[model samples]
Target chain A: MTENDILEAAKQAVVAADEEKAIEVARQAVALGLDPLRVINEGFTPGMRQVGDLFERGTMFLPEVIIASEAMVAAVAILEENLPAEQKEKQAGIAVLGTIEGDVHDIGKGIVATLMRVYGFKVHDLGRDVPLQRFVDEAKSSGAQLVGSSALMTTTMVGQKQLEKLLKEAGIREQVKTMVGGAVVTQYWADKIGADAYAENAQEAVAKALELVEG
Target chain B: MTSYPTRMGDGHAVEMSTDELRCDILAGTEDAADRGRIPALSQEEQDYLLDLFSYPGKIVGVQPGNEVVLTDDGSVNALYGAQSSSGVGVPLSRELAIRVYERAFCMDTMEVGHPDYSFKPVKPIVSLEQQCLESVLSSTIIPIYYGAMPNLALYAKPDGPFGNPADLLPQGKISEARAAQEEAAQALTRDMVYVGRKMAEVGADGFNFDTTASAGDAEFMATLQAVEELAKTTELSIEVGMAAEFVLGMHGQVTYDGVRLAGLYPHEQLKLVEKAGAHLFGPVVNTNTRRSSAWNVSRAVTFVKACSEAASIPIHANVGIGVGGVPMCETPPTSMVTRASVAMVEIARVDGL
Candidate 1:
């Protein structure tokens, strides 16, 4: 079959949330002398990206995002499983993520987590209400090169800057770069707090996080 | 002075000191005594009973009698009064209370937030908290207090949108009466704890601590953790979950755009208080308490389900029912209790209490 035939099938699998079908198509495409990396870049990632967009635009809600992301992760996992040892080394670095203390709302954070996981990063999420100490503690423990702390409240957003301070005190400031986001947190605030990057939504979050970890 | 110098009931006058009555119960005369159905306790049980029940001059304070008082001067047994909510008094079971106190001394729920101490929870607000505690417990069922305070949305940003609409209220003054209103609530918690202790002592089954000032998880839970600690300390065994209204509570949130607000996520954070070991369920914040439909409590129950799923813990949930809808305080007491019991049971109704 032509390359377009395989990519369309992979895209449909996500729309239908048929992870097995998505994986099967991805597996077959790889076996058919196709480029698995191109299948991911051209097929699975684009479909899932659309899912996030639909969600942001209010055309879709959480269950849809969750389902689409699930299908995408499954297909990517299949492609990842058969990746040549040399190629796997080129994947994205890990970034530990979470919402800081007293702010337990997670829709935005969850979307970002799903986006990060489906892409290439190994994510260690600390969930919500994460105190500054826990942020420092998780970053140290995970040995992660990036920490994404998203706050949903201004009062708690202050905790994010406190997180930067704690990380510096722990002597791991240079070990991990940080990204801050949420509606109230702006690039200006990011600069003020000494955070390295800022993003507006889940996709931007993943892009910004990659920049921090890779740079 | 003896509280029961003479028997006023059909039984003839019998002089007895409060301590003597304790002895009779301890001596097992209480086992065969005439009265309504009361859980019979052995000598060991009586001693356990006296340690928590004796009304003398301590914080777990209460004069020894069948009556339960909620007070702060150490006059009667009253922890937030949520646990003793069953009206059966000492709902923790003698075994559970001993178990809880054995491992708990009210300090395990640490003050993890505010390390800078610049934003310490307003205190001797503790005194005010006591007063508000009394206001809520003054009734048998919980009462709802609509918050009158500033939310980032209500007040405008320096140049951002104001209220839900651009002009629902003036720039940064959506609820102008907030400060005065907060002081009133502050006084309520303090005064209520005093009166609530009296109410509990006089046998007002339990108290539900509802407030408008409680906003997010940390704000709500910090207050709740303190309340739970306070409840455990005074032996009042009351249940309190800060009902979250998206707009206001004493936390005095300044962020007008919640969607833009970082750190805050819509999760039922109450279920995660691993140390407080108190029966609770909330961070109920998706819908507006003032504008949402009457069935909003159900959404809160669902939110608890989600948070419980996230934490991998089982939690019971409850939402206030009142005159705003079919279930009013005026309804038969049994009806109100049945609704609350059914909702709680729906979530974590396990075999054991």
Candidate 2:
């Protein structure tokens, strides 16, 4: 198959949620001496991005996105394994993501985490209902450049502001950028809470995380 | 009061006091002998039965001629014929009652009856919680589904094609693909019914169907139908919760389709829900720091007002606060209380109170 054909096959595999097919394709690309990064950027990433778009457009639901993400993760693992240590080390940035305390809604955060991984960012997902200090501690411990918090309720979204305050109190506010998003989180609220960035959905979260780290 | 032995429908004759008979009748378990007699119950006896059934409890056992004991076993609690006291009786604020009345004509004529007399209570403005409780007691419809997250894996058919986008399309023919989608949608509805059954078993007053996770019009409608079926059997009110944006169709996000799809706009969706016999509308506002941000607060207020105006049912605005917008934690207790107070005031204002 042509390189484009191989990349297309990988994309189709992820969209099809065929983890074995995605891994097989990634393995074949590795055996063919294809650049792993090229395969990821051209193949798996696009597929996952499409999944994210489909989810946002209400054409796909959470389970589908989750399965697609699993496929991509399987493909990426195979591809990353073939890459050299130095190349593998070069990621966009480290990020700490979690649902704020008292909120168990993690689907949105999980989506962002998966998308960030596809975009070459190392993400530390703290799952749902993460403590305020743990966010700061995770960022400090992991040397993370970005911290993303999600809450599906207005009552718990206040933790985003509390996290911002805690990060500043930890004296590392300048070192880390914060991103907040959820069912109710708006960019205006993010700004009001002093978060560095806000994303409406997972796709925007990837773009914003890239900008926050690169810019 | 005279004591008498009455034969139950099961051919069992039991002796009971007038009060015991009144309790049995109020509880809707009167013996066959007295089923159609319609005995006169004092106001105190009526109120006692009304309060007993207002909260969550069930009659566990009936000591034939003596007493009917109620236990807190989470059974369906319903008041059969309690006198309705407009706002106080149903526990709703007058503004909310007015809004509900304006939208749903069925509510206004809803009779709260007793063995002696049935009267429509005057609608008085009351607190939201009291209103919800009163609505539950009077109507026996408790709204469930706030913060309810069903596990998707539980719904997926084993050995069935799911979680695969390829399965979403026809392999070679449109008919085949359509069948797959239909089956998938049916599976989703089954899951919703399962959730609804659990909610009903716990004596939910009503159910708020969560629309955030719905994939498209097909799945959304399927879930609605499933909940509607539950409501039919359980006699619980149905409330549909949608993101405020989805309801308003803001940002050009509204998808237009016929009744089958409901056009994906807020107003259209509201109409469809009403047509489907929903009793309440919950518009969920997605914003952080709901109390602090004027924009967020105003947006929520506007959305609630729009819902109230569009539908006759009571509008329940689901707004979050704090870091991730979860209402339960991390934020100070005062902040949550303040946000709730502010939201209530704003909602009341929208009702022109």
Candidate 3:
């Protein structure tokens, strides 16, 4: 198959949520001496980005996004395996994410984490009700480029600001970027809390995370 | 059936107590068996339930779904689920059901349905509806969970009584979860049948079937089946309550080759509900914080307008704002309420709702 045909097939595989087909296409592209990064960036990533777009536009539900993420992850894993160590290591940015303390709503956080992984972020998801100290400590330990916190309730959103304060107290505030989001989180609230960025939804979170890491 | 008490024969204007009136109303409607089992409602309670149904506009009640189950020492822990060791799990007594209905009504809520925090047992729905219809206003609505989350205490059990969270699995070992969810959905339908029958027996208005907490298309469709089943069995109007975002998700958001899209927007959701033979619609907007500013108000207005436009039946916006223990904004509560109300009115007028 031509290079463009292979890339389109890979993208379609992910969109169709055919994990095995995605992996098979990625393997074929690698065997064809196609650039592995191109296979990921031009093929898998675009497909995942479309999935993210569908989700953001309310055209996709969590289950579809999740299945697509799985397909993307499967294909990306194959492509990353074909990359040289140095290039592969440098390709994806590291990040940490979680639902703040006193909140158990993990659906949104789970979506963000999955999308971040799809977009080639080395994500450390701390799950729900993560304490403020854990966020800072995990970011410091993992050397995350971005720390994202989600809070579905206004009461628990306090933990996001607390996490920022803790990062400062640890003298690492300047070392990392902080982003906040959830159902009740507005850009105004983000500004009020002095967060580096605010994402209204998972797609926006991915975009902001990219801007923070790349910029 | 008992007859209504006539006005005083002497022509002297008599101030009859509410209890006397209620007693007379109960005499004709309630049989000896029912009277012995359920106590007569006080005048104040009757008025509380009636006033909500008679409100000028749509009736809305918001529950944050945050009611927690406390340990014996009173520390709040897990969510109040079906098996929680609290007042929630116990079958509600006849008197308690009346009080529950009364409290919901007093909150300007037309429907007496909430999450695990408060629910009437399926058995008492008929008696409760009967009492309300006889002494109070019609149009009382009882809300039922169509696809409820599995009782956490029953998590991982093969025969669990509700939809297990694990049922959303992608592949193998999901059969048990699917079976469990189907069983739960069937159970819910059976309960709906019981409730619908009772409501019909008493000449009560109707009930609402809510699927807000459903996890995905499977759970949602299963719940819809239950709703359809209830419709087939009853002539009383049934209102369907769905999560706004879930509806949005189902309309066109997610696509999987083999997966059917269950997402719908407000209008589409209302259409589906209408096709199911329901005559009322409740679009629940459950936010985690208070509407402290115009931003929040604008969001509410946008959501309300969408729901109002899509609904052919009366739309009840079940809005849950502000967590229980959260501190309020600097703005006073009264001011916040006024601002929110004004925003809603302006939006309604602009949209011609």
Chain A fold similarity by TM-score, each prediction: 0.86, 0.83, 0.88
Q: Give, for candidate 2 chain B, the lowest lDDT window spanning 10 residues.
A: B68-77
DockQ measured for candidate 3: 0.10
Clashes of 2: 49
State the lDDT of candidate 2 residue by residue for B1-353, as single tens digits: 65544322111234555565455434431211121122323345334333322213222122244221111111111122111111124544433443354345322212111111100011111132234434444442322221132222223233244432222221112244334445665766675566555445545555555433233444455555665677677766665656433421111121222444522434446666676667765454443332222223333344344455677655544433321112322232333333333443333222211
Report the C-alpha displacement of residue A87, candidate 3, in angstroms. Answer: 1.7
Off by over 4 Å in 1: A89-91, B1-353
Ranking by TM-score: 3, 2, 1
What ranking of all candidate models by DockQ puts the best one first?
Answer: 3, 2, 1
Candidate 3 residue A94 C-alpha distance from true site, Å:
3.7
DockQ of 2: 0.02
lDDT of 1 by residue, B176-262 (tens): 323332333343344334533543453333343433123322134333334454455454434333333222222233222122111
Compared with the true structure, model 3 gives a TM-score of 0.60
Stretches of model 2 off by over 4 angstroms after superposition: A102-104, A117-120, A153-155, B1-231, B234-353
In candidate 3, what are the lDDT values of residues B1-353, reduced to their tens digit? 43222222111122334444444333412321131222333345334322322233432232244121110110011122222212233355433443454454332223333233211253444464456444434332332211122122122233344534332332222444445545554554455566666656655455555534334444445445545766787666665655443443321222223344355444445556666666666554333232222223333444555556556666654432321111123222443343334333433221211
- Candidate 1 chain A weakest lDDT stretch, 10 residues: A55-64
